[model samples]
Target: MKANPKAKADPKADAAAAPAGSKKKLMIAALAAVLLLGGGGGAAWFFMQGGDAAAEDTPKASKKKKKASNVKPHYVPVEAFTVNLQPENGEQYLQVQFTLQVDGPEQATLIKDNMAIVRNRVLLLLSGKKASEISTVEGKQQLAAEIQAIVQEPFAKGGDEQDVTDVLFTSFIIQ
Candidate 1:
C-alpha cells in the first residue's frame, strides 16, 4: 500500500514550540550583554577613579608629615652676643647683639671656630652701610638675612652636617 500524499499537519503544536525556543534564545542573549557591559564599566571605573585618588592621597599624607617634621627642634641653648662694627665715613658707631640658634654640634663647632672671621665680615658689612640701612624694619630684616648667610656659608662649605636655624638681633644700639 502507498502512503497518502498529504498528511494531516498539527499547526498549533509546531507554532507553540517555535515561539518558545526563540523566546529562550532572546533571553540568554540579553543576559550576556548585560553581564559584559557591567563588567567592563566596573573595570574602567576601578582604574580611572582609584589611580588618581591613590596618587593624590600619598603626597598629602607625606606633606602633613613633613610639616610635623619641621616643627621639631634640632638645637637648644642658642648663642647670643654683641659685635661692634668698625666706624666708617664719619658715621656714628653701630652695635648689634645677635641671638643665633643652630641645629647640631658640628655647626656649633664651625661657628665657634669661625666666630672672629664672621664677626669681622659682619662688621665690614655694617660699616659699609649708610645709617639709613639700619633705620627701617625692612632694612634690619635684610641685615639679619645677610648676617645669617655670612655666618652659615662658611660652616656649610666646611662640611658641617647641619644648618643654622636663625640669627636674631637680641639688641641693637646705633650711636
Candidate 2:
C-alpha cells in the first residue's frame, strides 16, 4: 500500500463514524434490557398467581371433604294413610293421603294410637293454608313439619320423647 501524504483524513469525521457504531451497540443493549425485564416480570407474575390460587383452593378442598365426612345419616320410616275430616262449619273435606317413616317402633306405636288426633290437627292446618301455599313444594314441607309437631306433642306429653324422623307424602290430593 502506498501512503498518500497529500490526502487529508478528517479526525472529526472519524469520531462521527465511531459514534454511529457505539449508538448501534447502545440500542442493542437497551433492547436486551427491556426484553429481560419483561420476560422476568411475566414469569414471576405467572408463578405468583399459580401459588396464590393453590393456597386458596387447598382450604376449600379440605373443608368440602370434612363436611362430607361429618354429615349425619338421615333416617326415616314409611307409613301411608288418607283421612276425611269435618272442618270448621262441619263441612266434609277430603285430604290427600300421607305417609310417614317414624324413626322407631315405639314412635310408630304412639302415632298409631293417636292417629285420630294427628289427622285432625293436620286437617286443621291444611284447611287454613291458602290453596297456593299448600300446593307448592315449600308449603308441603312446612305442612309435614307441622304434622310432625302435632304427632310428637302427644307422645312428648306421654313421656316417650322419641322423634318421628320424617313425614312422607305417599299420596297428596286436595278437595
Candidate 3:
C-alpha cells in the first residue's frame, strides 16, 4: 500500500516482461521471414517454366487440332442404278447401289446439293462398262475406285476437290 518511489520495480517482473517482449518480436520476425521465402519460391517456380507463351498455349492448341481431326465422317447415299452393260457374249444388265463416304459434312452437303450431276456422271460410267469388267471382286474394286474418282472431281471449275473416301456397294446384281 506504500509507494516505492525511490526503488526500481521487482527483478522477477522485469525478467518476465523482457521475455514477453522478445517473444512478440521473435514471432513477428519468423512470420516475416516465412512470407518472404514463400513468395520468392512461388515467383521462381513461375519463371522456371521457360516463360514461353507458346509453351503455355501448346496443350490447348493440340487439343483443338485433335478435335479438328476427330470430325465424324459423313456418308452420301446414292440411289440404285440399273444400266445395260456392253454385251460381251450376250445381253447383260448391271444393277448397283452404293453410298459415298466423304471426309466431312460439307462435302456430303455439296454432293447432296448437286446429286443430279453425280447421278449423271455415275450412270454414264456404268453404262459404258462391260458386264465382264465388273463381274469379279477385283473388277468390283476397280469400279469402286473409278466411281470414287468421278465423285471426287470438283463440281465447278477451280473449286476444291471433293473428299470422296470410299464407294461402299450395297447391291450389285448382274442379270
Best by the lDDT measure: 3
What C-alpha lDDT values do all the predictions have? 0.67, 0.65, 0.89
Candidate 2 TM-score versus the reference: 0.44
Clashing pairs in model 1?
A: none
- Candidate 2 lDDT by residue in tens digits, 64-101: 34443344424333343344443543444445666665
Best candidate (score: TM-score):
3
Q: Which tens-of-lDDT digit does each residue in 125-153 have in candidate 3?
A: 99999988899999999999999999889
Candidate 2 regions exceeding 4 Å error are: 1-94, 155-158
Q: Which stretches of candidate 3 lie over 4 Å from their true place?
A: 1-68
Per-candidate clashes, comma-separated: 0, 3, 0
**Rank by lDDT, descending?**
3, 1, 2
Worst 10 residues of 3 by lDDT: 60-69
State the TM-score for model 1: 0.49
Candidate 2 vs candidate 3: the TM-score winner is 3
